[model samples]
Each structure stands twice: as structure tokens, then as C-alpha cells.
Target chain A: MKKGRLERFLESDVDNILYWVSIFVVVLTAIIYVAQIWFVNYTGRYDLLECRLKTMTGINCPGCGGTRALKSLFKGDIFSSLYYNAFATYGAIIYILFFVTQTLERITKGKIKGIKFKMVYLWIAIGVLVIQYLLKFIIPGYKI
Target chain B: MDNNFNEEPNYTGEVVGEPKESGKAKASMICGIIGVVLCVIGCFCCIGYAGVPLAIIAIVMAMMSKNETDGELTQQAKIGLICGIAALLVLVLGFVIGFVIGFASAFTGA
Candidate 1:
């Protein structure tokens, strides 16, 4: 069967695509983090970006505090990350493990089989999010 | 593509020429489904950006699956890839629209 250009690219350029995408993410993260620092220094009273849902609805959404959690994670403060948003904190840990495992499998050329990414794992993660969501409302004096 | 990746028959007990799916492909499919679902959940409020990451994950997993396995996406993985792309486009579009609105409001003092 003949292949189209897009098909050929997808088949042959998987590594290149992943590489560029990862590079883009890293660069974007760096830019956003730097901008955030500058904004904080300049404003001193407000964050540069605000959560739309919280601002509009006066209630925390499912992913509230995710940005703070990510910032704390980037700063290597795991406890603060978890305090900000347990879901994002745990999700980052899981993603790091997944990424490391993927890199190892590629480096080893599949000689060492890493643990399979199971559907059950995602379900468990969702379960944790649901628990946290309920607790945010149930517990008094809990930060959003 | 290594046809012998599957050492045993699947739950259906069907031993075909194609082996069972690698974890990456399965993850791709799962992430794609999640991405689309999240995008469909109304890309307003806090949910607007939720699907973007999942879509990226889906596409990445599909690419990795192709790289490690058959050099071609599995049927499910291809579906995942398409869904991921669709979700990404929708979410990004919503983000752009939101940004434009915010900018206009700030300029107009509204």
C-alpha cells in the first residue's frame, strides 16, 4: 500500500515529533515561570494569572490550585505541592515515573520491560480526585 | 514490528498474527478518550484547559507506541490520535477566544 505524506511522517518521525513537543513544553514552562516571577515582583499584591472559575463562580473548581501545585513541584517542594493540590502533585509524580520508565525502555530497547500503564491506574487517580473534591467541600477551613 | 511480543493468547484466546497492544498504545487510547470527554464537558470555567494536557499525552503515547512497536499506529491508537488532535484544537481555540475577550475587556475598562 502506498503511504501519504502525513502517514509517512507519523511512521518515521515519531522520535522527532516527541523531541520537539517536549522541547516546546520545556521552553513554554520556563517562559511562564519567569513571567510569573516578574509579575509577582512588580505587582506585589496579585498574581499575574488568576483562576477563572474561582473568580467567576466564588467556588473552587476541580483543578483549583493546580498552577500553584505545579509551581511548588517545579520548586522541589513536594509537601507544598501536595498542599496546594494533591491531585496535581500526585499526577506529576505519576507522570515523572511514567516518563522515566518510557525513557529507560527506549534506552534499553525494550530489553527491560517496564510496568504497563494500566487503565486501573487512571481509575484510581480519578477516585483520588473525587475524594479530594468532596473533602474540599466537606472539611471546614480547607483552602481551595 | 515484532509479531512475537505477545507470549500468550489474550483473554479471548485468539492468537493472531498481530500481538496484543503495547502499554503505550493502550495509554494513548485511554488518554485520548479522556481528553475528548474533558473537552466536551464545557470548556468554560476551570475545565477549559483540562483537556489540553491529556490530548498531548495521548498523542505522545501514540507516537511512542509507534516508535517502540510496529512503526505504525494500532487502529485504536490512530483513533486516539485523531481524538487527541480534535480535543487539542477545540481547547486551544477556546483559550484563544477567552484571551481575546479578556484583553478586550481590559482595554475597554469593562
Candidate 2:
């Protein structure tokens, strides 16, 4: 007939759903990345969807080489990772940090704190966007 | 019929205030701007994929405004949501049909 602290907290919170959802997505993306790398190595080919996309479209989408970039990073091939998608390696770092922050905040129920690096993050994001676009135009034979 | 029996109860929960309406409105406004920007970009650059999701998100955020307690932003949310939804529908339908027909033709060699 008695309830615990965890149950009481859950009853009071609406944000738990969002928090859990964020964790799920982060975990799922990581799993998918692993599977994709295995498939790529086994087949000696990237995704057929992306291959066809590049052949037909003649220009790369922002997320075109993100998977390859992640794969390369995991394999410790820094130059290959950059070649695949420079922004993506950095993106994975940010994603992991985001996941950790959200998880900590959710578990603490309001006591957890966050860093104040907004301006720096904004500048870095803008820089990456510009660099990605420039590299698309400048770098030859590095097509995504 | 059970609505009469289940009359709405007055607020009696912990007094944690809801998220600010301005924050929600700012989010909706950003989504709308991004949607329009994507649509334009897609049109000019022939990459409609980027714009479709943006438009959808904008519209959903806009529709959420109806439930918002922010009086100042209600109209903005409604308009933005409606426009975004409309744009997304048009673009998605147009692309789907085009792709279907093209694929059919390619397969049939006609």
C-alpha cells in the first residue's frame, strides 16, 4: 500500500517521456551505425540508396556521407573519416554529450546542471556549415 | 454521454509553471522560417527532401499553438502551422506522383 520515491517522481513528471525518447534514439542510432559498418565491410560497398543518389543527383546532401564518416572514425581512420564527412565525426561527439546531459538531468529530477557554452557552440556550428559547403565545392574526387 | 459525469477538475497539481509561451512561440517561429527557407532552397536547388521534413515540423508546432496559453502567439502559430502543412502536403504529393510515374515509365520502357 506504500509507494516509492521513483513512482512518486514519475507520477509528477511529464518530461520523463521526452527524456527516455532521447536516450532511445541515441542508442538506436549507435546500434544502426554498427550494423551499417559491418554491412559495408562485408559487401565492400556503401548503401545502394546513397550510391544511386550521388550518381543521379550530382550533388551531395548534408547527411550523405555521415554514416561513412562515423564508420571511419570508429576504425581510427581520421583522414578517411574526414573524407567521408568532416562534420559527422564532430556531430557524434556532440550527440554523445547531448545524450549524457539529458540522461543526467532526467535522473537528477532538477538538480543537475548544464554548461554555458552557447556562443562558442553557435560559432562552431556556423563554421562547420560553411566549411562543409566550401569543401563540397573545393575538394575534387572527395565526392560524398 | 459520460462527459457530464466526468466534468473537468480544477488544477490541483504541484505548482511547477508550464514552459513559457514565448519559448514555444519562438520555436514555432523558427520552424516556420526554416520551412519556408527549405521550400525555397529545394525549389531552386532541386533537393526537395530537406524542405519536406522542415515543413512538417513547422506545421505541427504551429498547430500546437491552439493549446498554447500564450495569447500573443496564438494567431502566429495557427497561420504558420496551416501554411507549413499545406506546403508539405503539396510538395510530398507532387514528388510521390512524379516518382511513381517516372519509375513506371522506366520499367515499361514507354
Per-residue lDDT of A25-130 in model 2, one digit per residue for the tens?
Answer: 3465456556766887899885422433345567665555766787898888978887776666665666467557766775797588533223354346446755
Please count the clashing residue pairs in each candidate, in the order shown.
0, 0
Cα-based lDDT at residue A116, candidate 1: 51
Alpha-carbon shift of residue B107 in model 2 (angstroms): 6.4
Residue A79, candidate 1: how far off, in angstroms? 3.9
Candidate 2's C-alpha runs over 4 A off are: A1-48, A75-79, A109-112, A115-127, B1-23, B26-58, B69-94, B97-101, B104-110
Interface RMSD of 1: 5.8
Tens-digit lDDT track of model 1 for A24-136: 54466556656766777898845335555566567876677777888899999998887777877776777677667667776899886545555676677777667877888
User: TM-score, each model?
Assistant: 0.56, 0.53
Q: State the TM-score for model 1.
A: 0.56
Worst 10 residues of 1 chain B by lDDT: B40-49
Q: Could you tell me the TM-score of candidate 2?
A: 0.53
Error of 2 at B49 (Å): 8.0
